[model samples]
Target: MRRASGSGAVAVAAVLGDGARYEAGRTQQTVRAGQRITVSGHGCTVRQICAYRVVLEPAAEPDKAAAAAAPSSPRPVGGEADGGFCFTTNPTVLATASKGFPPRGDTLSVLDNGGVRRFPAGLSITVSYVDTRTRTARLRGDCAAVAVADYDNARVGDTVEFAGVLFTVSGLTERAIRLKRTST
Candidate 1:
């Protein structure tokens, strides 16, 4: 195991003693399995993260304790796709309406049984009845045509690109699109 000792604000990470892996911010991957690691920098903290698995571990036989405890077929869900931030498929989204519209910051929720545990962002859908004679190029979509625009197509994970606002999708509904507050 190898270790780097530092006392400063910058992040300085390293292995513990022998056969440990430390590559900057990517991951403290150690060649030695079950080797403990210690990270020291700015706010030095220790979090015991599950070792990354290369192959899926399988479930053990119901009758055999040893087999049940040690199976190599599956691993935990959510890999590099989840990035780092934890999220839920039915993440509650909240959005505020523009002036004269419904109160903003309304919350919405969706049910996904597919273990869909990902909430990217929400979008604010504005519906307006366009005059057939008048052509609004910018405000031209199936959503802006009817008096009551339905957000049926809006689903979780779909990027809601707006002219002025950026949001992470939380949930979606026929009448509303769930959005979480975020930067521009």
Candidate 2:
């Protein structure tokens, strides 16, 4: 089966001394075991390299179309300022997950995901810290980075403001900042 995007897996077909042979399109490479390499649709650490045909699993796609088709919140009669990425008739619905953030930050991977790719430098985004228990936007910010386009200005300890609330930039990447709500 073909996947619309992302990498697939590959397997070895022949044992050639120190490596195994696999055809990634027209090009062939003898990848040794334990090598960290990426082939056309395949990538990741090679768990074991031996003679077996590669089996490619289809790339998993998120069902964004359905979510996108969900009824949108109505626009205000008069636009509301300081309203960060409003999506519900109610003002407290959390958007971090639909916007591609993890349900919660285990460490800083959440920041890196947004910073390095989804919300890259120069792109303005409305950010909020959602408390998992209540799933509400505790602190919100409408922001742009002050430095280069990769969002490298965001470091582990800086802070920014949202509607008078001070949220600390808890994690970062070259293009994104991960924040946590702090008592102000």
Candidate 3:
């Protein structure tokens, strides 16, 4: 589960014992605070929604068999062991602020101006800019120039497709923008 940063929403991605997957664009639903959302076959109540995280209370005990079958950690992608990407506010400075720091166990790679990094698939993301408000960021497709109107209102937790790949706005701050590769 991940909070929507500025938005008071949380994205819950879960899989059930029956192999039913729940995530953004699939079984996506909006529920009020204190409401319960059932993902696949599991139910949980939204206890609190904060600036950085969402608190949830499980409605029932987990199925031991299903829990055992679940992977201990998410599989890595793009040859990244942590499966996350970080971009800092100061393109000239590297990882100077906590907000711009990469996730624990993740490596940092500073991209030069006009530089492009290719992932395992055809997905390639270029940082358009990190918002000064610290609440949003814009991603360009293959380092191409994108119009401001194209992504002016994109919020955290929003998913956008570029080429054939899907990327999720995972985290945002004044110093950094974090994106997670969803699919290709």
Each candidate's lDDT (Cα)? 0.25, 0.30, 0.40
For candidate 2, the per-residue lDDT at 82 reads 17
Give the poorly placed runs of model 3, Cα more than 4 Å off: 1-25, 63-184
TM-score of each: 0.20, 0.23, 0.33
Model 3: per-residue Cα lDDT over 54-138, one tens digit each: 4455677543233223223322243332212211112222122222333443433323233344442223445555665656655
168 in model 3: Cα distance from truth in Å?
19
| Winner of 1 and 2 under TM-score | 2
Residue range 118-140, candidate 1, lDDT tens digits: 22221223422222232111111
**Alpha-carbon error at 72 in model 3, in Å?**
5.1
> How far is each candidate from the true structure, as Cα RMSD in Å?
21.0, 19.4, 12.8
Candidate achieving the largest TM-score: 3
Local distance difference test, candidate 3: 0.40
Candidate 1: Cα lDDT at 115: 16
By the lDDT metric, which is better: model 1 or model 3?
3
Candidate 1, run of 10 with poorest lDDT: 136-145
TM-score of 3: 0.33
Which prediction has the highest lDDT against the true structure? 3
Q: Give the clashing residue pairs of candidate 3, or none.
A: none
Backbone clashes per model, in order? 22, 6, 0
Better of 2 and 3 by TM-score: 3
